[model samples]
Each structure stands twice: as C-alpha cells, then as structure tokens.
Target: MSGGAQADTAGRHGFTPRARLGLTLIAGGAVANIYYNQPLLGLLVGEFGERAALWVPTASLVGYGLGILGLVPLGDTLSRRSLIIGQTLGLAVALLAAALSPNLACLALSSLVIGILASAAQQAVPFAAELAPDATRGSVVGQVMTGLLTGILLARTASGLVGAQYGWRAVFFAAAVVALGMTGIAAATLPKIPQTRPLRYRALMLSILHLVRSQPVLRRSSLSQGLLFASFNAFWATLALLVEAPPFNLTAAGAGMFGVIGVAGAFVAPLSGRFTDRRGPRPMVVAGALFVVAAFAVLWAGGAWSLIAVGLGVLLIDIGLNAALIANQTRVYALVPSARGRINTVLFTVMFVFGAFGAFAGSQAFLMAGWSGVCAVGILLAGAGFLVNVLEPRGA
Candidate 1:
C-alpha cells in the first residue's frame, strides 16, 4: 500500500475501543442536531400555522446548504478540532435561540443559524475518512454512518415523544444541553490531526468547480447519491400524511414507531461496508439502487399488506441509502485524501440540496396525488439512480 493508504488504514483500524466509541458518540450527537426538527414540524405548525411551520424547516435546510458551501471547506484549511468545537458551540447557541423564540419568525431564523452551524457533522465524516486506512475505508465509514443514521432515525422518535410530553421548546433545550456536553467530549477526546496549508477562500471555492469538471467517480457518485437521498427524503417527508389519514389513523407517537422499524438499516450498513471492501463500490451501488426500486414496488401494493409493505420499504430505503453513501465516501476519500474536507463539502452540499428539494417535492406530491403520487415519484427517482449506476465507468 502507498503511504497515504497506509496512514488511512492505521488511523481507522488502530483506534482503541474507547476512542472508537467516542468518535461514534460525536458523530451521533452532531447528526442529531440536523434531524431534531423533523418530527416536530407538526407541532410547529400547530403553534405557528402551516405556512410558517413549512418555512421554518426550510430555513434550517437553507442554513445547512450554506454551511456545506462555506463552513465545511474550512476542514481543509483549519484545525479540525477547533472547527468542530467552534461550530458545536455556535450550534448550541442557535438551538437555545430557537427554544426561546416567542414567534415563528424568531424560531425560523434560529433554525437557519443552527442548520448552518450544524455542518460540524459534515466535517466529522471527512475526519473519519482521514483516520481510516484505505483498505478498510468503507468499513470505517460504514461504522460511523451507522451512528449517523441512528441519530437521524432515533431523533425523530425522541423529538416527537419529547415534544408531545414536554413541549417543543423543551426539545431544543434538551438538544442544546446535549450539544454542550458533546462539545466538551469532542475537545477532550478527538485526536489532533495535521491541517492543510491555508488557501484563499476564493481559491478553495474554485477547487470544487475543478473537482466537478475533472472527477468522473465524484460526478456519478454524487448524482446517484443525491437522487437516492431525494427519494428517501420524499417518503419520510410525507409519511405523517399517510399515517394520519385513511384506514389507519395513527397518532404522533404511533407514527414515530415506524422509525424503530427503520433502524434495521443501521444494522445492515456494516454488511454493505464489508461488501464494498471485498468487491469494490460498484456492485454494492447497483444492488442498493435495486433495493430502493424494490421498496417502491412494495409500497405501491396497497392494503393491510401496505402497512407491512411500507415498513419493509423503509428498511430497504435506509439500507440502500447508507450503502451507497458509505461506498461513495470511500471512493471519494481515496481520490482526494489531502482534500477530504473539500470533497465532502461538494458531496454533501449536493446531497442536502436534493434532500431539501425532495422534502418540498414530497409535500407537493402529497398535496396533489396523495400516497400514490409519492410512491410514483420515488419509483422514478430510484430508476434514475439505477440508470446512473449503469452508465458509470466499469473499473471505477
């Protein structure tokens, strides 16, 4: 193995068990910040009205989009620990601002700030890439991503239950407290890694354009992952509508139970990583796309079977999404070991942008076509992703 590959493998594989657990916790805490608003959207709507609630979530997403563009690239230029710590502190204050807001506008503005600062989680992924060995990059990324997905899935359930019991304000307060605690842990535990020489901000921004123009794998992987994430977001965004209406009218608590079903994907993520290590990312990418397509088919088959079908579909969607994500990161990290942060900024900027679009499109789809419309759009997106995989260079 080359020196860079050797460093990656040693960094990933050589961690003590305690250190690994700490990294996992950091990943979970950082990612949970982004997802905390998801299940609380309905409550926000009740307090602020539907239009305001709809825009509030978008505010956070818009902030997140900007973070990917502006904040994440700092990983290449500054100390990782300082960047993570500063961002975490900023996020905590933003969450507290959201918690204390007296009106929808105040809350919405805070959400944007929180989302922008929450790019700390994005930085962690590339940090993990830097720490892992080339041979086992997929496995390392998979393990970390397991924590990430757990944070996302469990945050929905936790926020909904907490908001129902305590109130929405309490949800942000608790999140703020957790964020503070995690920031301390990160400062004490995260290892110091070498920083890249400083580049002009404008020059760093231009590098992404160069990456887009030069890298085939980055292009294909980013597009395919973006579409898959859009499809996944489309389902979750509209799920409440499905459960609240028609034959099965589940309460918020009951609807949150589906998040538990989706946790199965976290378990499946490691297998996908192992597959990526052995056979490379392409076969796994193709299989993941197919699994998502299958999920749409199952959801399309309505009835009592529809409930079981949708549950299975959620599992498949989570698995497929995580598999492709880890594989893509593994590949991209290899291509630009020195620029993992910049590469991830480009990758996640696209993913989150599509995710925001998916959420909006799903709502529109639900408003227009209902469950059938949602499923149709998902099928189309999955099919498009599969075609992208087919067109990818064979050896890559």
Candidate 2:
C-alpha cells in the first residue's frame, strides 16, 4: 500500500490495510534508529575495548534524553513533516559518521548525534495521534507503536545477522540508506498539517514544563510510563549476562534470537490500544503493571529451569511494557490536544531518562547479585508503577 493512501485511511478513522502498512513502516524506521546500537555494542567493544564501549551506548541515551527535551517540542512550533524530514537527514549524516568513525570516542560522539536526530521517531508518534480520528486514536497509535516496538526488539537480531555477515560498519551503512529512503517517503507522503498556534521556541519549552506541573493526568501517566519503561530497560540491559552464563551458555547470536521471541508484544500492541479506546487507560495501565510484576516472578522461577522459560518471561515483559506504553500515551494525548508534541516530549524524555538510569542500575545489580538482583530491581520498579496507578484520580 502507498503511504499516502494509508495515511488517508487513518485520517478517515477506519482500519485500512494500507494505513497499517504505512504507519508501521514509518514507526519501524524511527524506532530502528534508536535500537541499532544494541547488538553492535559487543562488536564495538572488540574493536575499541571495554571502557569506551560502555560509554558509547550511554552517549546515545543521553542524546535521546536531550532530544526529547529540546527537539521534540519543536513539533509543536514547526510542521511535523518538515521536522521529521530534517531530522531524518541529520540522522543519515550521523549514521555515516558512525560508520566511518576511527576511534571509540568518535563513534560514541557520533552515536549521540545519531540519537538526537533520531528523535524523529518521537515526532512520528504524535503525528500518528494527530492523523488518527478521535474514535480510533488509541488503536491507531497502538498499531504504529507495534511497528516501533518491533523495530526496537528486532534490531538486535537484524544488526547481529548483518554485522556477522558483512561486519559492523555495514549495519550503519544500511541504516543510512533506510534513513534516506524514509526521509523521502515521509516528505512525499506525510500530510502537511498546520500547528495549533505559532509559539516561539522559548515559549514552547516553557509550555512543556507548565504542562508537566499543571496536568494531573499527564503527571500520573508520565510517571507510570516512566517507571514501567525503567523496568523494561533493566530487563533487556541485563538479559545478555544471564544468557551468557553457565545455565544457558548462549552465544551473542543465540542471545539475539530472544529479540524474535519478544516480537510477540508487537502483535499484542493493537489489542491494548483497542482496549484503551473502549475502556480508558486506567484498566490497561493497572493490568499492564500486574503483568510486568508477573514477568519478574516468572524470570525468578526460570532460573534453574529451561531457557524457554526465560524466553517466555521476556515475551511477557515486552507485552506488558508495550501495553502500558500505549495506554499511557493514549491518556497523555487526550490531556493536551494543542501541544501533542510538547506533551510527548515530556513523556518520552522522562521515560528515557529513567530508562538510562535503569540500564545503569541493572548493570550494577547484575554484577553485585546476579539474576536475583536484577529480578528484585525490576519487580520493585513495577511495584512503583502499580502504586502510581493506585494514586491516580479514581475516575482518571
């Protein structure tokens, strides 16, 4: 299906196959930029050594956080299509830089730039929300998010396969080509929607802070999503260590296969969105939190058993994480129609910052207390998410 036709179907608020394909491609491209660094980390360490490799992913996370705070709000002030196209061009350049970097420091610095420009994905989500009709907004967002999650989960496997066959540099080169193609497609197919108001960059940033402080629904939803994502990040960040150990004794390629298992969550994302649209985000949010907690319990139980059990835990974690994410996004989008970009910026920025922290803490936990420590941390964070929901306004 052509991108424009699919977008038009979404614009009409009906489920069209073309619309699904278009949004999925857009979302996949956007999210892939953020995750392509994961499987490359080991390859990077082999070339650049441990210290620099450790810092490289952190640089990307930092860049992502900064992009959420600085670049995403521009979606409110500028045309989203233009913003996405511009960022896509920047991402292409950054990918090329990453591909050509001679040293660890250069790669790490380039990764930061890649991440900042990759905020295009963040812009894409709100754009999806804007394009979707009110009746199906949640479901549409869910469908788009499925693509995003698929990109994130599958990136590890894709990168590993490609890197193994053609070397690490090839991965970035492929990414650059994809970025360029996506940029052209987005520029041609995306509708030119006007912003609600013309606000100065300074004003837009200020408005984002105000929204965070003033909107009760936004505050609760953001916090809930933030904590949930923290747990999600923690689980994935530490998964390799667990799989590499005695019981599993898996190679990196085997570890990468777990990503394919996690793809189950993408299929579940649209269902979560439909539920959110019908029942409101509250029930989904609550249920999602419980599911995450259950995933941790399953991981704990699977310690001495089959690796299949661990794979099941990963699947549950992905499903719960994606469901909570869509539900929170649906609620936040409902709270501020005029400033979708700014609201999304705040939401994603907070969640990613927590994700970064979770990555760090998970590493520490793994080093200090093994899988049990990782499970403890994940469950505690999930519990905090439950508490956030409990404290939410009764009707909200």
Q: What TM-scores do the predictions have? A: 0.91, 0.91
- Per residue, candidate 1 scores C-alpha lDDT tens digits across 24-115 of 67777877876788778888888989876577777887887788889888887776778888988988899999999999889988988987
Q: After superposition, how far is residue 68 of candidate 2 from its true place, in Å?
A: 1.4
For model 2, residues 27-116, the per-residue Cα lDDT tens digits are 788668767777777788889998765777778867877887899888766778788889888889999999999998899899899878
Stretches off by above 4 angstroms in model 1 are: 1-15, 42-51, 303-305, 360-370
Q: What lDDT is reached at residue 164 by model 2?
A: 78
- Cα lDDT, all candidates: 0.80, 0.82
